[model samples]
Target: MTDQLTQVIAQATLKDGMRNSTDSLDAATHSAKKLARKLFEGLDEDKGGVLTRDEFEPYFKNPADAAEAFKVFDKDGNGDIDRKEMRNAVSRIYRERRALATSLKDMSSAVSKLDGVLLGLALLITIFIWLFIFNPKGTTAQLVPMATIILGFSFVFGNAAKNLFESMLFIFSIHPYDVRDLIFIDDSPMFVLEFGLFSTTFQRCDGQVIVAPNSVLFGKKYILNVRRSGPMWEATKVMVSFDTPLDVLHEFRTRLRQFVTDHPREWKGGLDVNIDFMQNQNLIQLSLIPSLVVAMEHKSNWQDWGARWDRRTLLMKEMKRIMDQLNMTYKLPTQPVSFMSGQNKSPKPANSLLGAR
Candidate 1:
């Protein structure tokens, strides 16, 4: 038992000695560092004066010192110092110094901003407390809560209200078309498929559907295609040689009108076939415009573009047939191109005057 107690005593004594040695060594190291710094500073000659620890100590005290410190760190030696540079220098000082003085100033500024926000909250709470305690039964209390509720509602649903309001206005004063009506926006043709309280939906010829806000449609210009409602007409240019007389154009127009009238399937009754003279040159260009209004009416293919295409194809075929009957030829405008093999005059004939000499 005595030997065991002695062993415990020795162990405890060794641990105590080691701990004391570590503490003494740490103290000696710190003192040595301080002495080294003092010796280094004493040996240096400050030919170029610089701000010392004491001189810079004041700026670490408060936010107002940002100006004074700016003047110190302005390496460009500008007479006027900027506040932003002062802030950057403060940040660098914290990094280089690793001391509590400059950090305390930054901590204080952050705490001040936080305190202001807390005070604002406290003011709001105080107003509520006063209202509840003193005027709980008054009309002002009732109106205030109602106003708050309305303001909150508007804040959350303002965009929805704007959309709905514009949609209703558009449906009344601006809407010029109905469902299935062909309309054009930005020169692109689209068929109206559906209308919503907030948006109008359009379907393209490719079967793709698009939905756009009503407000956008209301503010933009659109065209309602009246031709789609009844018969449709398209025009193309026909070219003929300049030798063709104006009488030929009139004759073609008469024959074309008669052919379309007889078909009854390709041409509408109200509008006649028109042949207008265009550019006149070596090649005479005539605008040949005919209608498929009667075809659309007789076929009653309101939404079938394929049926319309077939009607157009039939019209073109009839035009060709009528031209063949009238012995009228269709010409394409073309420019004659001449190529010179060389600058030499035209080659002499095989037995020309030059060969006879």
Candidate 2:
């Protein structure tokens, strides 16, 4: 079977003389699906057509770990994984592996830039030191004038020198964020564009460029590195009337879960739909917070901002559809109106109104 499958894939790749790039992509996808099928079949030792927890125990030493892995593969909480679910799980893993590879490449590029900058600085410093130590004209008296000039310049730019030193320290010691990293500065998402000795350049999702001094960023009490931390969790609240039927609420949660399940590539596996809070003071409104794994699509962390908003918008539209179909009622808080002691509750008679003829 393996030899036959390989032959089929090879034929698909080397098909008729008129093959194009799309043919190659199709062949690759076919090969991946075949491999996924093979893996799934191998795991079904009992030939039961579905994978059970026992089939996974040998690979995972801890029973709890095995159960968790099983749960991921079993998309419908069916306690067993069918061929279709296994294939989906395998595809997800493939995408994650590709994403990891891209992230590593980004890190490598960032480090290369850092190395180049450091090397340039080191060479410049070494040139000055070499000239001072191995001066062809070796008299201390000969260098006194140059030394005086250097001192004068240093004194004139003392503050700049201090900032340079501090910037160097920030680069070497802190290492909080890297080029192409998504970071939050003053609650705004900033994509690190270039890391310079004195200042760093950042770009916002809307394409605004910001150049901030290294001292300013380094002195901040906190920096949120979104990429290094992995995916973020975001929640959307839905306000519904407290009197909504239990069955309707159950269906609401089920539909949302189904949506997430249908888009495994866009959202993480699980979701949290719970009662967030209630407003009983002014109105009776129940807030249901459905927390999801923030959608971060691109290998570059900067793209996460756009992807997150896009996913949220999609989820909100889905929620609106579900609410409309279920006929769920959302209640708004009521406000009280107060009138002054002498104020007329009704408008003056039509004849007495301003500008009356």
Candidate 3:
């Protein structure tokens, strides 16, 4: 009877263990089925019943996790899982395993690409160092040559590096030109001032401090004063009487054009002449515009090409010469006279003056 009792006790214990195992399995199955039902419900919303890859993919961390979850849900031996069957089978087992797996893969790929770039840079640096150290020449002789090469390369590379760095900083919206350019304050006759990479700081002739960029200096339209091969920036305008006979006026224009053309080195280009008749006053005005380059030292002696004195001198000389040759009466008009008084004049009709010529 004792032996029988021992066998019954052992059997009872075995049965209990089997019952626990069965209970645990049944619980897991129930949980999985509940999760599958949730997933099916989420995928079959009224908005759109079809489950696309993006919709299904978020449930699992990766493809493998997704495959495993799908295997559990697809219980009917069919490759595709119907909504109701999937809901009754595998949702709890998958979690977000597919998403986690995909993230890991992407991170790995990024790290690999970064490693390749770093390796390439390291290899290039190693080659450069080896070339500098292992040459056949004796140490001292090689040192000088190597130093020279390195210095030259550094000079070029340094500027390039600086420019590239500045560009990068600019792209990131940072100001690189933070330091104020030095202003050269001097009363020296010669405009000698220090210049920086992008700006020149100097005192003008009037002793005013000016800071100008190299780009502005190079890009602007400048009037070069060609006095002793330097640019000059001076101009003059002259207005002459229109009462001069047409022949004499033509001669004067021809002479001025010829003079400018003959002395090409004196002026920037050729003289610009404008002649117009004032209809109301019945007078013609001749404007001669010319440019000349003068030496800096001879600023006191330099005469404006468009000055009244210069115009008178040139016009009188030419007029006298022409009058002596042609014996023509070419009188200069004293001044412009108005044909109509201010409020006393009626508005002239349009076509009346239009067809007057």
lDDT for each residue of candidate 3 in 204-279, tens digit (9 for 90 to 100): 5466766665444442424222112333433334334445566766676676667645633233334555674353
Name the runs in model 1 displaced over 4 angstroms.
1-139, 142-159, 172-175, 225-233, 270-280, 294-304, 324-357
lDDT of 1: 0.54
* Highest TM-score scorer: 2
Q: Which ten residues in a row have the lowest lDDT in candidate 3?
A: 175-184
**What's the lDDT of the predicted structure labeled candidate 3?**
0.45
lDDT of 1 by residue, 296-331 (tens): 222222344555677667767866776666566646
Task: Rank the candidate models, highest TM-score first.
Answer: 2, 1, 3
Please report, as a residue range, the 10-residue window in candidate 1 with the lowest summed lDDT: 94-103
Ranking by lDDT: 2, 1, 3
1-357 per-residue lDDT for model 2 (tens digits): 336445544544343453335765466566657776987888889898888999988888799998997876665554777787776655544444434444454455545756786798799779767877888566456678878888998899888767766777787678777666688877788887667667778898799998889877767647788867654556556678877787888898889888988876466656656766556743233444544454323321334566577777888899899989999886665544443435666544443433456
Full-model lDDT for every candidate: 0.54, 0.67, 0.45
Q: Which structure is stronger by lDDT: 1 or 3? A: 1
TM-score of 2: 0.52
